[model samples]
Target: MRVAVLGGGLQGCCVALALAERGIDAAIFDRNDQLLSRAAVANEGKIHLGYMYANDVSYSTARMMMQGALAFAPFFARHLGSSQDSLSISRPAAYVVHRDSQRSPGQVSQYLKTVHGLIREASGRRGDAYFGRDLTTAPRMWSEAEREAEFDPQIALAAFDTAEVAIDPAALAGAVRSRIEADPRIDVRLQHQVTSVDDADGFDVVLQARCGILRERFDHVVNALWDGRFAINETRGLRPDRPWLHRLKYGVSFRLPRGTSLPPSATFVSGPFGEVVSYADGLTYLTWYPVCLQGISTDVTPPEWPTYPAEPLRSDLLQGTLKAMAQFVPCLRGLDPGGLEEVTVKGGVIVAWGETDIYDPRSELHRRFEIGVTSRGRFHSVDPGKLTMAPYFAEVCAGRILQDIVR
Candidate 1:
């Protein structure tokens, strides 16, 4: 049977690859020439050691992430045609550093213990099939002076040795795409814009572009639009309740000098404006810059507030970040400003379900099934973390599609 996957983003490509692996013919379609390109470009290339959301209680998200990480391993290895050593799957010892006065060391310890226990429990239930073994242990506290000596001079107390992995997000996605395209069963059409979908005599998917209207028929179709839910609503003429549309804030990456000594591991620093900062490929990246003012999403992105752009690099945000960095590692202060090369500002409404849910599981499932049901289809969506999760998503979607068709 022929299947049409909508969107050439990671999700769509993954779903298509899975379908192809099952000996099913699938066609991937996208309206954007730069599918997954935007999200891919903004990536810091971290494989994520599963600690980013250690505090999250969402069992489903946690479970998916764990399973997804493992699934990604083989998929990436095969797709990239590279050994584990070449992939930069750096299993670094992660840390969460906070000021001693801001939060008690005991509270921080408790938090780590709770998260570690949860990870262990979750891994145990999943057996060796998931990331149970790969999960990192909770961090241990370091004295203020010791942290200063080891890191930089500004560090107070350091919680070191948590599990985390890092990678080049763009390279990873490109590798996956390259591998999938090698298979003749899959056809990736670039510069094709899918404007609408209709169930006429058969499933008709329409494409509108500068060229003209192109049409294709498919037995199944999937919709995976990153932040572009409006396209789906316009195409299907259906308005599904999406509470978590744009509630997330992100940061841009600034390329540091060619020869800057970065920390060996990724660090999560909490201060007046907590941020996730990491240095890779001579670029120091900072994200989660708050745009909220007075506890509300304000016009001004905060912690650094008004001083941004005018002084960009010297802005309050970067200064606070630098201060936090110094607290964790004193050497950061001495790092030459000449080493700072370029800065890219990236802030967007992170998709979420109200303030509580970050992802819509139900909508995701529906979109997957829609693609599976379509013949000769493709789908796309922007996900900086797409490389780590798309493989499993593809496998699951393919299995579901086959099941639906056979039954």
Candidate 2:
């Protein structure tokens, strides 16, 4: 049987690959000219272990993230046909708690310890390694002297070094694309925007392309579009039942000059601060929430925004991101922006279940346990909330769809 995987981002590609492996012919539809060119390639690829969601006191978000993080290495290694060590893994992150963060240092520290304990237990039980690293030890908090030396004391209240690391999504996307191209059962349909889906024994997927509208029938359909997922789901009478937000967040990527030194890739915690990641491959990524965040929409479909900012606006974002990041990573304070090589600014739409932003201590953004595969008979809608959840949730979506066929 043939399957239709809507949207060729990471989630769609993963689902397509999984189905192809099962001897099912699958077609992937995307608006971009190429696969994995949108949100899948943009943004910092943080394989979160739930340390950032300190405000979610229930620990559910952290637990869900840990499960996905554990499965990330093996899942991609199997699909990409490469060893986990070959992936571009960033340096372990030092989570710094800001002086005015929504959660206190003590509260954040307690939450991290609890999450780490769960991670260790789950890893041991399944014998699943996180990026091939040994996570037997707990995260270590920095001393006052160490914290002062690594970060500006005025902004940073405390720091902890965890085994959490980020994979370069750009590199990972290339590997995934190669695998998809080599697979015979998976078809890649570029520049095809899925306008809607209708029930017709199976499903009829309507598409909008330059040539005009087109339609195709499939035994099953998966709604995996991040940009217009809600709109397509609504066409199938599956409107959202809860409050949500589609936030457009930006990230800056630049290459550092030779022999440039930087602190460990760090993330400021429990609020709308920012993060600075210096990858081993000489590429540095910076994102300051207050400046890089562009727009937010509560509608089923978010308003269109340029993925790449032009002119002085782009320069403003780069300068502002670095300046804001330096508030915590003191080493970047006086670095000349001109010295940075190949600087580029790009962002993607982030769909989450929240009415407010992360600034609020009580915002639903603090937790992300509400996402995954949701199905209504033969049609499925997936919301892989973060990049970390894409592979794991894709497996779930594929398995559930296969089970439906058996019955």
Candidate 3:
């Protein structure tokens, strides 16, 4: 049978590829003329290894996520590149930063031990393990990191090197596109947006385009539109969940000064939302780990919310990013920091909510990607399954939906 997959971001691409592999007819309908626009392109490309969540989550949850992260490298290898240019993993793994919060040094030490233990366990034998440290490298590397991407010594409580990585979003989109297009059975419609869906024998789908409205019927419709969840549910005559609101964020891209040398490939600072990643091209810089998470309290949600609007490059956002970045990377301080250049910003959407209007990062609610179904199970909408977790998530989603139908 044929199925229509809505949206063409990473999760959508993964789902479509999975369906085509299953010998089922799958078509991708996307609004943008190109693939992986919106949040996909803006993704700072961190393939988490559970280090970021060790202090905030249970050992079991962290362990599961770590194993899940390992899937990304194999997946990328199958789809990513040639010898000349490739999507290799990030260097220097990551740094779990600490702040002047309630968590003490003793507590921080225990958490690092736990994270390192998991890394050793994943290696297949019980053995001793260690982590990398030193915020300041040598006179050379330290000078470079300071001049290029600043790393503050005090912000880090403990530093650990785990089996995590980062990949180029552009390369990823290309690989998926190549694989999907190679399948003669699949049809990919560009500039076509799935407007809505309804129930008949299966489901009637509506499409909106510059050419006008078009409609079709499909046995199953997978709503992989990241931010379109609320509207799609209404298509099935369901009341929208007021609690499911989109939280806005941003990805700031910038460059370091010329005649400068960078210390490492990627560095994730823990204290404040800070990250400095050297892209595959090996020269550009991006602030990872948006420090804005703390501004959002546990109890604040809409109607009484203090969240940023869904706007990009606004004065407030630009200033906010600059201020946040400087906090963890002091080298970035200057009226006209000649060291940093070409600052650009992109808007991002987090398809999540603070339960009852209270946002808690530690809660399972914000930790995992969301997959939901209509009351009758005829229609489904997926949250943004991060790049690292997309492959596994796609398999689970596809198997659950198609397994019953095949039987």
Candidate 4:
């Protein structure tokens, strides 16, 4: 069957690749010239272990993520020329220390036990075995001596050793794209923006180009726009009735001085401002990636977000991030404050709802409805783990499409 997958971003690439693997002819389209550019330039590129979600997770989103992590490993090894050695699995403990009160030792143990149980069950293991034996935890109010002991003075009740895997998102996307392009059945059209999709005996995919409007007929179409669902629908006059579209926000990342290290590997530091911080690459790079609050909306592009200098310097947001870093890493206060060099920010719309959004099948409402009925079926709305979970999603979507065709 001929298929058209819109958006050359990570999701679209994966979907196209998966279809090609099934011996189905497929093509990919994207409007962005720099589809994987931002992720390639910035991000420490950590491949996440599926343990982030709880054991009782029943949502399609969660299943896709879990299955994707497992699927991506072999796909990367076989197609992308990635080796198992390139991957580093670490159990970095995460902690949530209260400001005023102390959690009892029993409470800490119980918490860890619950977490361990969840991880074990999710990983399909029996008994009380912890998923990451190296993972451990400790809780204590920081003494002044303790404050001076580590790089981050504010750390309390260190939650140590949670399952985390880091990989380059850009490299992963490029690898998948390369593999798909190698297949004779797959045709990748870069810089081609699909404008509409119509089902007339079959599916008619329309594209808007500088010269004129272009159209291609396919047996099926899949929309894989990462956070661009609303924009695409509006463009096609097929906006969903429900308020499913999420607000757009920016993720700001800055390159720290070449050699800084945080003790106990990478940790997510919770700040007073309700922001999360993580250290990577010998602590030389710190990201103040903002988790956009739910229900907030923005039309601002990444390059237009508030910046530091008139020209290419550092972003103002990055400066604010450094200030926050100083609260925990006091040594930062003594370092020579240099101008922000090469600050790359990725601005896109994201679903900012609570944890429930990640695993809900209803969240796929727009995608499912758009595919079969509307000519606007060429886009996909996905959650945060789109890159990590693309393979599973592709399989599921392909299965659904096949079922529909058969029926």
Over 4 Å off in model 2, which ranges? Answer: 83-85
Model 3: pairs clashing at backbone N, Cα or C within 3 Å: 97-270, 273-291
- Model 3, TM vs. native: 0.75
Q: For model 3, give the 10-residue run with minimal summed lDDT.
A: 126-135
Identify the superior model by TM-score, candidate 1 or candidate 2. 2
TM-score of each: 0.71, 0.97, 0.75, 0.69
Per residue, candidate 2 scores C-alpha lDDT tens digits across 1-407 of: 77999999999998998887677789999998889987888778999988889998999999899888988887888877654456788888998899889989899899889999989887886654687787877888999999999888878888999988898888888888888988999999999989999878788999999999998999899989987799999998888788999898899988877776765688898889888777877788889999999899998889877778887878899998888777668777767887789887988899999889998889999889999999888788999999898888888988987887788
154-191 per-residue lDDT for model 4 (tens digits): 44444334444555443455555556667797787766
After superposition, which runs of candidate 3 have C-alpha atoms over 4 Å from their true positions?
60-64, 80-85, 116-150, 237-242, 255-259, 263-272, 288-323, 330-344, 356-366, 369-378
Between prediction 1 and prediction 3, the one with superior TM-score is: 3
Superposed on all Cα atoms, the candidates' RMSDs to the truth, in angstroms, are 7.0, 1.3, 6.5, 6.8
Worst 10 residues of 1 by lDDT: 365-374
Best by lDDT: 2
Clashes of each: 45, 0, 2, 20
Rank by TM-score, descending? 2, 3, 1, 4
lDDT of 2 at 112: 87
TM-score of 2: 0.97
lDDT per residue (tens digit) for residues 1-407 in model 1: 77777667666777777788788888877655654554443444454434444333343444445456667666655455553335444335446554532334465466556656666665564543332245544566656555655564334455556665656454555666666668798887777776777875556878776778888887666655444534553566554354333333434446555555665444553333333445456555554333321122312121222212344434444455555555555446665433455765433333333333222223331111111122233322223233456677677768877876688
